[model samples]
Target: MAAEPVRIDDPADPRIAGFVSIRERDLTGREGLFIAEGTVVLRMLGQAQARANGFAAEAILLLESRLAGIAEVLAAFPPEVPVYIASQAVFDAIAGFNMHRGVLALGRKPSAQVGASLLGRLPGTSLVLAGCGLSNHDNVGSIFRNAAAFGADAVFLDETSCDPLYRKAIRVSVGSVLTVPFSRAMAGEAMLRGLAEAGFEIWGLSPRGQVSVAAIPPARRIALVLGTEGEGLPEHILASFRTARIPQRPGLDSLNVATASGIALYQIALAMGRVA
Candidate 1:
């Protein structure tokens, strides 16, 4: 059953401290917790909690007017999870902005797992996305969205990559960050080597790649390695891994990493029999 809302009279209420000034704290905030905003994201968070895969909703804050609309969503979560409601003024003050969507959730990040450990656990047949120096949160989110769309088993990130759980990234991904399994590795090279050791055929995506993405054959396991936007996959990585290109026109230098990921994932997924 959906828990009855507890009205929040004060914007500075101690019970809702975690939600204060979300914009400022998003830049430098606590690690174990993340804000899940919007009805879609909150719904995904509820789904994540149902999975019980090391994720939980610490609390939910809503504009008093929105409680009725999200009743189904609230019902998905356990009654023990507190639901806090606030008037427009209090909600705006607490969030540091006019939160039009008015649906927000504090979700606990799952326990950390080492990159190699996560890679080692995947089944023999798997498709994965490996990101190197992908600092853009939106790109990170899109990558996970693409991975999930293409049925990738997991995503691996290097230390230089941005956290997918960043508020904007999570919204950009429409909550795929919470759904996809991901881990951060110490180094890009170490991540690639670990995937290789796990019997994953690693393919680095680069404009200068030797083969076209469509030409690449199927494999038992494949990891599509993506790099940052302008300065693409490092030369060393390009040299080390078998690379594939998207085959674009002469005027264009390269596709955005996120767009490139989606295209590559689609093609590779088809080859790997993950999609029709």
Candidate 2:
């Protein structure tokens, strides 16, 4: 396949608009598009491409000199996807940061059905469902990555949680975001009820909780409930299920949500003999 590269000299070129103000509200808020940086993430995105599921690659931006190599990497993509080449300086200007590897791509958000169906298929599964106030994308991504790596069956995000596909979350997950199945729960109450109805024993992770996480018995299916950094789970939500906390040192307040998730997931996996 011949590599066709379009030279973009002007930063303001309307064709490259997706690459602008990625950190600001213009692109994220208005268009709901987030930027993914580095070659590894871009490659992950390419590998996870699905045809029937609204997978659309808008553009690929690369350094002028690296165009050939990038073209080779992108050879799998159809001809309709635009490939843009720019000088390192121009690429930096457009990306609003140093172009780490001179490669980036614009991808559409997968539909909510993708997540919903992914969760529904896994019956009697142990998983993580992030609740309200956990807004950090990196933390959310890390939790997802750990969930997948540690053998958690799926993930569910509450209404207040950040988008798992957000660029920062995706990058932090090291692209594990694509591998892990996830869905959104409109309210914390609904999430808890659904998991209970699905026959999962819900375990809430909190610092002040009475029972240690290790005490929770291994079950056929479990749902680990994780809340935000400072506020923890609301009273009503806490009252809805059994609460468990990671044992910690005398002075330390608590573990970060992601770290707490990893420990809890490891324990569950170990109990099931899934981890050696």
Candidate 3:
């Protein structure tokens, strides 16, 4: 059983300070920490803790009535992790808004690893998701979700890409951002170059791709390159890398980046025997 939760009658209490004014704080950076919301996400936080993968939950805050329902999830964390509970009035006041769901967690981001170092550690047979100039947090999170669902070994984001751990992004991803291992490349092209040098067959996804995703042959190591939703991949990337498209009815501009990622990852993952 999980330890009994501590009651917080004051929104200003220092122990629960990290969770105060959540919406406002989300607009600013979390400074190496992030808020995990909802039961599914909290469960993911618990799982991340279990893996000892460098992520840790510093504390959890719940609406007073939510504790019983989440007792099973709470039990997953170690005894030392504090669980704080508050009434609706106190929780809403602390959050600066109506706090309906009531499930929240403060989790620290893992230590950073350089792109080359992370890629070098991957096994010979691997699949990865590479993002270039992707600015949307939801897209970033969804990419990680697709990566996890399709068994992509890791995700690499260019410096221009948004942080996958952004709260809205994390919630939209259903917690995949916490589960998928990822690294950021300070120079986008340099990251791709390193992957290419590491023997990964990099395929850029574009609307004007020469081959349909279904037609691409399997490879021992592969990386799928994706870009922003409307602009798509850069010309230089398209010109240089082998590119693939998801065949669709003509006339629409393109698929949403998240949708395209799911479809593409599903196809490539199946071809590589990563998915059944």
**Top lDDT prediction, candidate number:** 1
The TM-score of candidate 3 is: 0.96
Q: Name the runs in model 2 displaced over 4 angstroms.
A: 1-3, 26-32, 50-55, 68-72
Model 2 lDDT, residue 17, Cα: 91
Lowest summed-lDDT stretch of 10 residues in model 3? 112-121
Note the residue pairs that clash in candidate 3.
none
Candidate 1 collision pairs? none
lDDT accuracy of residue 254 in candidate 1: 76
How does each model score on TM-score?
A: 0.97, 0.88, 0.96
Encode model 2's per-residue lDDT on 229-263: one tens digit a residue.
87888888788789998888866567888998899
Please report, in order, the local distance difference test score of every candidate based on alpha carbons. Answer: 0.90, 0.76, 0.89
**Clash count, predicted structure 2:** 0
lDDT of 1: 0.90
Give the better candidate number (1 or 3) by TM-score: 1
Candidate 1 Cα errors over 4 Å, as ranges: 114-116
**Which structure is stronger by TM-score: 2 or 3?**
3
Best candidate, TM-score:
1
Worst 10 residues of 1 by lDDT: 112-121
Give the per-residue lDDT of model 3 (tens digit) for 140-239.
Answer: 8878888889988889988998888889899988999888888875667888888899999999999999999998799999999998888998998888
